[model samples]
Target chain A: MLAHAIFFYIFSLIAIVSAIMVTVSKNTVHSVFFLILDFISISCLFIMIGAEFLGMIMLIIYVGAVAVLFLFVVMMLNVAQQKNQWFSARESSKHIPVGLIISTIIFFELIIVIGGWKYKPDLVSSMSLNIDSSISNTHAIGYVLYTDYIHIFQLSGMILLVAMIGAIVLTFRQRSGVKRQSYFSQISRERSDGVELIDVPSNKGVKSDD
Target chain B: MEYLSIIFSETYKILFLLVPVLVSVAMIVWLDRRIWAFVQKRQGPNVVGPFGLLQSLADALKYMFKEVIIPSSSNKVIFILAPIVTMTLALISWAVIPFSATQVLADINVGILYLFAVSSLGVYGIIMGGWASNSKYPFLGAIRSAAQMVSYEVSIGVIIINVLLCVGSLNLNDIVMAQESLWFVIPLFPMFVIFFISALAETNRPPFDLPEAEAELVAGYQTEYSGMMYAMFWLGEYANILLMCAMGSVLFLGGWLSPIDLFPFNVIPGAIWLILKILLLFILFALVKAIVPRYRYDQLMRLGWKIFLPLSLTWVVLTASFLFYFNLLPIN
Candidate 1:
């Protein structure tokens, strides 16, 4: 238990530090790397807390796919060296109070949730699913996800599908006057499509349009 | 004191797993080259050490002594970290791999997910290496590799879902054990083929190796690396290849199980069968490298997104429905 506590402290410390570094790093690429480090440390903490499935999925989804895309965009736009001076930019001042208020609200909401958990333990336990100790972490989660939370789980999936379709509809466009390779047409062309046989052309040495 | 001893024992076991893997990495490089040479009708590395078996070893030594020339304009930290990251991530995924019924480094419950996670993160190394070099070719190579890996990873994930559906467990050992009666290769043949190709794309092996294509990008993301650093990339690439082969064996080829249930075949240790399967897959990988031409970038993208994605997704639906209909899912 002591060792677990020590390791948790270490991972959380790294996560916090890297989370800060993600915002503070001047280079966009470095920021993305720091964000990845943050995700990794958080996932490690999740694994340490016996949520191995969630932890691995977090790493796969965030570090593997999303973070790579982040790096891809940051690298492609050649914005790695761009200085992040949010406060100094004159136009940015317009959004500062709004950002602060939103963040403050989120922070307060989290505090309230924690406070409620401590003060009203029964209330917190009311919604919690029964975790079977005999089953593995993955099996337990599967039971809960597929049974108790199936509707909400499927609703989230539907939301994601809608978002994806909306994104595609927003961005997809067709351009005219572009010569594109039609794979079907290219592959299906036969000898009959382009060849002609003439009988009397042999005597006149195949004269042009005669 | 007990904790200290436990840590030491864990380290010992880790060395046991890792040393063999690293050594095999070297041996497989030689094997890959020899296969390529044989396919082209030539003797490969015959003069080195009994059929040039020591060639890769010698190459490693040479790389050790050579100068690691980091480019002046490159991001030194990331440039160096990239190869280490690549090599480590490639090796780390092996922790969950079961050599036999009882032999594994870490028997985590979500073993397949851990492997999937680690393999997916492999792109970071190449992307970091490519971007940190701050050169046109390397940067372009990194971009190409990033897109290629991401695209194929989608299909790979769905295809893995098919296998998972059949096995009904994410545990690598359990997945292998589920194949006691019949190997998944017999039933999930199409998914296996798609997976094999995606594994090629995932590892950036030839035909799908647009990221480091020599003719166009001049070694691509590896353009700026030199000496041991370059060797690190090669080591990581080969290790990743081995990981894919291991995954293929685990998911489809029944892992360490003997092909025949009879006495003679079952007498051999499970690890040997596992290694033989990996070697067979590796040989196919090498054969493809020797036989097939490199894919164009657009065509490769089309293959991954248009063809493999739909095909694998449909296979997942079919597999799930069939399993549901036949009551064939393994109960973990």
Candidate 2:
């Protein structure tokens, strides 16, 4: 228990620091890298808490796919050269105080909620699906996911499918000048399509379509 | 005291496993070169040592002594961190990989998913390296890699679902154990092929190595990296290839199980069989690299999204239905 506590604190610290770095970094690429570090530490915290499945999933989804996408866009836009200015500009500085006030309020609200929330004594018993110690975390999730939460699972799949289609539809374009290989034309060409075996009267007199 | 003891023991086991892995990485590099040479009918690194067995070690030493050049425009911190992340992730994924029934580092419940997740995360190293270089070619390479890895990962995920459906468990040991009756390659042959191809693409191996297409990209993401930093990327790449081979063996090739349950074959330990299987798969990987032509970027994307994605998704549905209808789904 002590070891677990130590690991949790360590990971959470790393997570918090990296999270801050993600926003505060001057370079966009560096910010993305920090964001990845933030995700990794958070996932480490999750894994330390015995939610290994969720931790790995988080790593795979956020750090692997989403963060790479973020890096891609950042590099493509070449925003790393842009100097980060939070409140230096005269006009932009005016909104800094307001932003800080709102952020502080939100932060306090979150803290208050976390401090006030408590688990009921009977909460464990009242749960519909208790984690079975006999099975693995993945198995437990699958059991609940396919059974009681089947409809929600299917709905999420639908949502993903919709998102995929929407993305394709949004960025897809047909450019006029681009030449593409037509496999059908290439594959379906007959022997006589181009080969006209004519008896050349003489090398000089055999004129082609040139 | 108890926790300390556990940590110490775990560290020892990790060290034990890692030593062999590092040694094997060196050997595999040498072997890959020799095999490629054989395929091309040329002498490989025969002058270094007998059969050039010590070539990898010599190369490692050379890299260590060479100067690491950090480009003036590059993000120094990220440029360094990228290779470390790549190498670390490559080695860490081995934790959940069961060598045999009991020869694993961390035999967690969600072992397969853990492997999947770790393998998927490998793209970050390439993207970071590319972006950190702050060069045109490296950035282009990184973008290409990002899209390529992301596209193939979807299909790989779907293909794994097919195996999971049959096994009804994500545990690596259970998945391998379930293959006791018959290897998944027989039943899930198409999925196996798709998974292997996806694995190749995921690792940026031949026919799918558009990210580092030398003719255009000029060394791709590693354009700015030098010395040990460049070598680290190579190490990570080979480690990933080995991991993919191990995954292929574990998921479809019956892992540590011998080909036949004959007296002589069964005498060998399961770990040996697993190693043999991994070596076989590695050979296949090398052969594919030697033979297959590099894919066009558009064709690669088309294969992943248009072909593999639909194919693997359909296989998942078909596999589930078949398992359900036949009452063959393993009742976990």
Candidate 3:
């Protein structure tokens, strides 16, 4: 129990610091790297808390995929060259009051939720999908995810699909006079398309441009 | 006293595993060169020891004595940290890879997932190394690797899903035991093949080694690295290769399980069989390096996204349906 507490403190501290660094870091690449670090520490905490499946999946999706894309974009766009000024942008400062108000509201709401929450007397019995201690958490989550909440689960998948298609649609374009290789057409060509037994072909090059 | 003993025991176990892995990494380096040489009809590292056995060791010593020149314009901290991260992450995945039914470091329940997570994180090393070098070639190499890994990782995930459907459990032990009747390679042959190719791309082996295309990018991310740091990258690369081979053997080839049930074949220890399977897969990896030509950048992307992705996704659907309709899926 002491060890667990110690580790929880360590990981939570790292996560908090990295989360701050993600916003405050001067270099855009460093910010993305900090974001990655934040994800890792949170996942470590999750793993420490016995949610190994969640932890690993979070690592795979957030750190492995999302943060990588973030880094790729940050690196590719050369965003590190532009200095980030949180408070110095006079025009952007107009939005600061609104942001602070919204943040404080969210913070108060979190405090209320954490401090005022309590377990119902029959909370264990009320849950339709109870976690069984005998089985691993992975199995328990799989059992519930596939059977009990399959629709909501698939709804989220659909949302992701829509987002992906939207991104592609936003960026995809066809340009005129820009020759693109059709691999299928190039591959499926026949010998007849390349060679012909014309009598006058040898002398005139068979009007090769045609 | 009790905690101290536990710590000591764990450290001892770690060393027991680490020593052999380091030794094997050295041997695999030697083996890789020899295979390449055999394919080319030339001698490889034959002057060091018998059949060039100690050549890797000699190379290690040379690296140790050499000066590590950090580029003046580089981000010195991250530049030095990259290879260490690479080497550490490479070896870290081995903790979950079971050697036999009973022998493993962690033997965690989500072992395969753990492996997946670690392998996916391997890209950071290259990206960091490339970016920190403050050089154009390393940066380009890093960008190529980042994109290549991400693309190939998608197909790899889908392929693993096919295996997971058959096994029903995420545990490595369960996966091996689920293959007691037959190796997965026989039934999921297409997936196994696609998985191997993706593994090659994942580990950045030749044919897909665009990240380090010597003719184009001057060794890519390692362009600025030298001496022990460079050796670390090399060691880590081979270690990652071994890990991928280990994964292949475990998932498809019935890891540590004797192929035949007869007395002679079955008498062999499971660890030895596991090692043999890894070597066999490694040889295939090396043969691929020798025979295949490197892919164009666009072609590599096309292969990963256009071909492997759809093919692996279709295989996943087929595997899941076959198992579902026939009630052949393992029930844990």
- Tens-digit lDDT track for model 3 on B41-74? 9998899989999999999999999999999999
DockQ winner between 1 and 3, please give it: 1
Q: In model 1, which residue pairs have backbone atoms overlapping below 3 Å? A: none
Off by over 4 Å in 1: A80-88, A196-210
lDDT of 1 by residue, A1-210 (tens): 778889999999999999999878788889999999999999999999889998999999999999999988887775743444555567777787998999999999999999998899999468657787898888888888888899999999999999999999999989999899999998999999867786775557766655
CAPRI-style class, candidate 2: medium
Off by over 4 Å in 3: A85-88, A118-128, A197-210
TM-score of 1: 0.96
TM-score of every model versus the real structure: 0.96, 0.92, 0.96
Deviation (Å) of A134 in candidate 2: 3.3
Q: Between which residue pairs do clashes occur in model 2?
A: none
Question: Chain B TM-score for each model?
Answer: 0.98, 0.98, 0.99
| Each model's lDDT | 0.93, 0.88, 0.92
Overall local distance difference test of candidate 2? 0.88
Model 2: residues with Cα > 4 Å off, grouped in runs: A80-116, A119-125, A128-133, A199-210
